[model samples]
Every structure is written in C-alpha cells, then in structure tokens.
Target: MNDARDVTILGEPERSDRPARPGREGKGEIHLVHMYPREMSIYGDLGNTRCLAARIRRHGYAPVVHQHHPGDELPEQVHLLVGGGGQDSGQVTVEEDLARVGDRLRSLADDGVAMLMICGMYQLLGQTFTTVGGRQLPGLGLFDVTTLGGEERMIGPIVLSTDFGDVVGYENHSGATTRGAGQAPFGTVRHGRGNDGSDGTEGAITGHAIGSYLHGPILPANPAVADALIGWAAEASTGREFEPEPLDDEVARQARTRQIARLLG
Candidate 1:
C-alpha cells in the first residue's frame, strides 16, 4: 500500500458474519463510534460526529452515535470511528484506555471499518509518539507511522490535493509524523506544511483508515471525505452499495471556498 495511486477509495467489502442490529422494523442502522469525546475533543472536533450523523440520517437509515470514553466498553458492532486532537496531557489520559481497546480496534479495521482520526488521535493510531522532552508514548500501531514532537508547530489553514479532490482544513500540530515502510499518504500538501513540513504530504490513508492533522474539524469543510466514509460504512454493514440521498451542502461549500481563496492569497 506504499503507492496511494492504486489504493481503492473504499476498502474491501465486509465479510464479517456478525448479523446487523435491527433498526425500525428490520432496517439496518449504521453504528458510529466516537472515541474519546470527553478527552480528545478540545478542538470541538465533535462537530465531525454531528456532521456524520446528519449525513447518515439524511439517508433514511438511523445512525447511532456511541461515545466511547476512557474505561468505557467498546461496541462490538462498529461501522465507523471518528476521533480528534487533544492536548498532550489529554493524550496521556486516554493512553491506557486505548491500549485496552487496541485489539478490538485492529479487529474492526481488519473487518473493513472506516475510521477518521485527526492530530492527537492520529498520532495514537501509529506505532509511537515521542514528546519534545524525549518521552515516548505507545500507539495502536494500526498505521505504520511515528510522530516526533517539535518546538516549531505547524499551524495555519491548509490545502491538500488528493485523487478525490482538494481538501481544506486548519492544522495545528507540533508532532511531525513520518510514515514507516509500506505506508501511503492520503494527499500532497498544496498550501501548508504536512506530515513533517518537507514531504509535502498531509495524511495517511490505508484500507479505509485515515489519519490526518487537518481538523477545522474536517467534515464541515470537506463533505466528500465524510460521505466516502459513510458510504464505506454502509457497504461494510450490509455487503451492498450505500447510495446516500443528496443533501444541500451550500454552507459547507461556501466555507470551503472562502478558506481556499484565503489559503491561495
């Protein structure tokens, strides 16, 4: 998967034998797990969850939001997972909890669960995150990447080019990440520092799991990614294509357009 040019937009179809939970007279509901809402949402990234739920609801299928916190039991059936950035201290707070759920997360990933992880959470999805003081923290190792803390933080509006389209967001991070062998970036940087500020890359995307530093909460400004994730989740749930009804995204489009123009300026 080192070359992202050939990486499929949606990952493999679900082959899990697990039966779907019944929703309103046998309709299958999409199970969305929001990780660390209490601790990892300092950036108001919970908006991403809300945006996803709204999109799913527009499809006429219920999308249940499960907020998973430290020490809380994880849901056995998860279609998608969304997590966000936090302070270094907050990262430490969720460390043990993440370790406890590592096996389950990896299992879900293998079963084609789509995930959107940002900044602090993105670092935790990798092998390790080293602090500026040289303290090392363990990660889930789902993505073959490592983040090293730095004094010079990359903070600004960012524009990234992907095969899907140009994604815009605001990034603020000091832990520059480096992809390990066999890893592919989600996109190339067009207007801001990415990954390590030298590679021109912004995020990592592998088999339905996405790790990025972009967090203008992400979804409000980039609905395409959100829809892709939901589409993948719907497909993974029923072994069929999930065609969502079109919803007006004028506000989101306006926000994105303004951000892009400003970034260009």
Candidate 2:
C-alpha cells in the first residue's frame, strides 16, 4: 500500500475486540477491496470503485474500501474485489502478485464474494493470455477462457445487451478471448468487437465474478450491473435475502441512452 496514494481507512471502529467473521463486520458493513488500484486502474477504471462504494452506502450499509496493492494479503472479510486494466508491464507485475494469492481469490469467489475484473485483469483471470510476440502469460484460471493477442486493437464505444439491461461502455483490447465449454458470457455484443471479433460475446461471468473488456469505468454507465454486484456481495456477507432500495438512476440512464444512440448512429 502506497501511503501517499492509499490511506489507512478510518471507518467506524469495530464494536467488539474479538475477531469478526469473514465477510461480516460491525453493523453489517461491506468490505470492498480495490485491488492494485495504483498499478492497474488505467482508463478511468477507478471510477468503478467509487460507483460501487456509493451504491453500497445508499443501501444503508457501511462500505469500507481498501486500496490494496500487489503482494498485499487478501482480506479475510472482503465482500467484493474490483481490479482494472494495465499495460504489459503492469500485467506482468499483477500476474506475479495474483499468482501468489490466486488460491485465496478463487476461494473467496467460491465463498460468494463478487468480483469485477476489467481488461488486463479480465485477461489474467483466464487460463492463458498470449501476447502479440507469442509470449504466453499464465493466468489464475478463475474462468474457463483463454486470450490471444490480435494484430489490431479494438478501441471504441460499445453497447451490449445483458439479462439485466442494455449496458453501454467502451472497449479497448487487442486480445481475442475464447470461452471453454460451460463458460457463460456476461452479455452478447450488440455494437462492438467483444471478447473476440467473431463471437458475439462481450464478457464472461462465472459464479459471482464478471470479467469484461468494457471500460467506460462500466459501473457508472450501468447501474444495474453495479447493483447486481452489490446484491451478490450483500447476500454472501449476510447469508440472507437482501433487496436493496432502488436509487434514482435517471442520470445514468440518460447517459447510457445518449451513449448508445451516438455510438449506434
């Protein structure tokens, strides 16, 4: 943790001195860890963290954000993990750190922790990511997918239709991801080159984790996706049926509409 960029969060103190159980804190607080923000949060991806925190707070539960870096141990009580894209150098660094804690990440996912990994982080969640030079970067294998670098990078605004709603964002990646059998995509590509130029898929969803190349920060433009993630986290933390009070997302809705219209037109 860089002291300059990351602060020791002074959230509400614990009510008791005893160690709290994982995923549950004082007064039903949700712990969100922004993994390697300093290293991986390129292309406005940090906005997703802020958006999630705001939505979680609106749900009447305390939200504690940890700006966790590579090499930091995974928090035992994490309810969600958000990571962003990076360049090749940054991907190598992140890969090393993820390799160290990959087991813990997979374990947390199995325990119902929600995860949102974008671009480079998304690629690293798969089995392997082959670079343009034919160098293969080993991944965490959290999802049944593989990525191979393409000659041309795909960069533009995009609109995708999902079960939740129509999500609009921008995608910038050269890697073509192919899903293995049984792997499900987050949505079908509606206006952009998605996981691969040929496939109509835009992202991958396994359990509670979402891997996508979309990066208009994603959550700001798609409140439904943000709420869905928080819902999953809250349920996992409380082990109860949780229904969050809906927030007025008129601005986001309008923004998404404009984005889709402009991009599609």
Candidate 3:
C-alpha cells in the first residue's frame, strides 16, 4: 500500500505513508462461519464474507473461515459469523431446518460475535419475513426486524453513508424490514432504498451485528466496510481501545464515486 518513501531532516524519521496493516500473522486467528452459503448465496451476498476474510488477511491479522453445512457443529469461539442472501423460495425450503439452528445461533449472538447478514439472511434475522407468495417463515429474531414480502424486488445499485463513510453497493430484495416499536433502522437511505417497493428500511443492527439489504456483492471498492467488521473482531480480541489505519485512499475514492453514479442512475 506504500506509494513512496521520503527522508526527513530529524535523523531519518519514519512516516507510514503506506496503508495501515493489522497485526494478523500468528498474532491470533479470527474465525468466520459461513451459513448455507450454497443454498442462499444470492446476488453478491457471498462477497460479503469473502471481502471480510480478505480485509482481515490484508491487515496483519489471520482469519479462519469455517463453512457450516447441515449437521456440522458451530464453533464456540467464532469471532465473526456471516450469513448471505438467497431467494424467497430458497429461503422457504430451508427456513424450517435453519430455524432449528436458531437457539444455537442466538447463543453465538449472545456471546458478542460480530455478524453481517445480507438480503434473505437479513430477513431471516427478524421475527418473520413474509414473502410475496403469502408465506410467513419464522426467523431467528436475533434482531427486531419484520418483513412483508412483495413482487417488486429491489434490484440495483444503492448509496449509503455511515460513520465509516459513503458506501456504494447494490439493493436486491423483496422483503421490507419494518422496525418495531423500539427498533432502529440500520442506516439512513441516501438513495435507492433497498426494499424496492416499501420506503426502503433495508435491515437492522443489534449490538455488534449488522443486517442490510444492500449488496452488489458490496465490497472490494469499499474497504472501509471491510475494515469496520475487522475492527469489531479486533475490539473483541485485543480487549482494548481498537483503532485501524484510515481506509480512504485515492483509488478507493474514485471507485466509490463511480459506484454511487451507477446507483444514482
């Protein structure tokens, strides 16, 4: 990530013009649990996990990714867990069996492992996400979101801004996430609300978990998003004030602008 090296007047001072790297080599390992990545890995949701693991590896950190298929035991020491999007029909097929893992998942959630769930996974985190087919499948309810499915699926680019920065990704989902009496929306919609039909309350976040309907497989261009998740894992591991190197760069900035334009169009 270094562009160049320069000499300073004060007896050769060192400046970190290169990108910040987390100490991941043999330092410790952060584990990622992939849930039904095959059955429901729709749109770019799978990219979320990939970007997450990559970002961690880019930094000085070591990441261990574990795929959780049917009949596999979930790790008790997972630093992060990622669940990707899927189609509603696909969701229905696995909803019951997946729900069986709810109690164990809730236990993991309670353990303070950071999680990122997109699209169908986002809908499944709620109490129930009703599909256009008039089916209301139960969710893990790890978050306080509820979805009402519709025909007009939200599929396209989108723009979102958070403490991290302006992020560009795609929106593709049929269910609308409605925060209940005391629930908070994940982030304000700058443009292209994720749930196309409704007023675009894509998903919710409870504690260290984030569920969003936006995904262009949403990453690569936005390293800050990846760093944000990595930061969460770092916070859990180091047990101290966690700070990461700035994620903004010229290449990243231009890419972000182009992505937002596609969303605006």
Quick one: best lDDT, which candidate? 1
Clash totals in order: 0, 0, 5
Per-residue lDDT of 198 in model 2: 81
Provide the overall lDDT of each model, using Cα atoms, as 2-decimal numbers: 0.83, 0.82, 0.70
Ranking by lDDT: 1, 2, 3
Q: By TM-score, rank the candidates, best first.
A: 2, 1, 3
In order, what is each prediction's RMSD in angstroms?
A: 9.5, 6.4, 8.6
Each candidate structure's TM-score, on Cα atoms with residue i matched to residue i, is 0.88, 0.88, 0.83
List of clashing residue pairs for candidate 2 = none
Output the TM-score of candidate 2: 0.88
Q: Clashing pairs in model 1?
A: none
Per-residue error for 80 in candidate 3, Å, reads 0.6
**Candidate 1 vs candidate 3: which has greater TM-score?**
1
Residue 242 CA error for candidate 2 (Å)? 1.9
- How many residue pairs in model 2 have overlapping backbones? 0
**Could you give candidate 3's per-residue lDDT for residues 244-265 as a string of tens digits?**
5434457867988987776665
User: Looking at model 1, which ten-residue stretch has the lowest summed lDDT?
Assistant: 1-10
